[model samples]
Target: MPAALADGVVTRIPTSRKVVALTFDGGAGSQGAASILSTLRSQGVPASFFVTGEFATANPALVRQMAAVGPVGNHTWDHPHLTSLSDTAVRTELSRAESAVRAATGRTPRPFFRFPFGEYSTRTLALVHASGYGAVGWTTDSLGWKGTSGGQSVDSVVARVLAGRTPGQVVLMHVGANPDDGTTLDAAALPRVIAGYRAAGYGFTTLDALR
Candidate 1:
């Protein structure tokens, strides 16, 4: 199940489109952030960004730039695993990130949150619901965090996303400073990923649309 619908969480939109939402987590590194936004704009693609509060504050300009391009969601203060934190801690994380996003973008984020590692509990889910945000997870992950030298092979990443994708799929990638793990494949593979999806007749949307 996509993160939006996991644990039977529901959205206001009816799930009836051959559309998928592409989401990038963390990172607002100067050059990398510019490149990602440039690529998306040039390709006419829109994405959802789940940004950490620290990242948003560090790169307020980039956050505004991204928000101008598409929807931005809270990815928590430091990208901690919400399920491991107590309920009060989890709420604090969500609240702090939400505050940062609102301060940077001048608009409150939509009801969208992605767990740091897709790890959550019933209590976390309920808190997310109570916070009025939909919990989002990915159906197809590009695994771009693993910064393999050959990992960015456009053909392979495209193949993976296209091979397993279904309507309403949520695709996950990253925009943070390259992970020590070989997952930076996302940045290198991004262009091809977008092209392949377009070729496959899949329209891209933000998580707000997914919801």
Candidate 2:
């Protein structure tokens, strides 16, 4: 049975295929955005990008590129931890981000939502569910945001995802939102990650498929 959250949203997968989803979050940088998109395009891999409203507005071209290849989900306006915000604030964040993505891509994304930093309360989940968005959390984390030597290593990240991830897994990564962080490492690791997964007989899917 699928795991149902507040407001009747289901989180678990309904299928049994040996496929997982790759999702990038918070894309607004020029070089980092271009590099990641190009890598995915070159590899013929599709990924979901959970973008903040502000970032989408600032980098509309990047948003269009992401949407052109795969699905673009809402990641809030400023990447705030939705757990700490009121319901009204949560709505604003999601609505603004959805609007920006639609304006940039001219396509409305499916009802998918990834909470920034994976911080969400029951109330936040309820709000998201009521708003018709499925709350997406990862099954395997690359820890690419940590900036540790291990986290910055592409081989290490790919190995972790390939070894631990199973069907319907959502592999979490970032697209250079934090200036002081190691999102560059994520960009570097992407090609290896895709190759590793493909070699392991796993096909990538967007978050909409999971829903």
- Candidates' lDDT values, in order? 0.75, 0.76
- List model 1 lDDT by residue over 1-211, tens digit each: 2454445443223456777777788743433577788889988888888888998989899899899788898889888878889889998998999999999999877577777778877888888877877777778877555545535454576677777667777788777544454344566677888777778788888776654
Cα-lDDT of candidate 2 = 0.76
Scored by lDDT, the top model is: 2
lDDT of 1 at 90: 90
RMSD of 1: 3.5
Error of 1 at 183 (Å): 6.9
> In candidate 2, what are the lDDT values of residues 1-211, reduced to their tens digit?
1133223333334457878788888744544678889999988888888888898899988899999888898888888777878889899988998899898999765477788878887788778877778777777777665545444566676777777768778788877734564346677788888878888788878766754
Q: lDDT value for candidate 1?
A: 0.75
Q: Determine which window of 10 residues in candidate 1 has minimal summed lDDT.
A: 5-14
lDDT score for residue 128 of model 1: 82
Steric clash pairs (candidate 2): none
> How many backbone clashes does every candidate have?
10, 0
Assess every candidate by TM-score. Answer: 0.86, 0.87
Residue 125 lDDT in candidate 1: 88
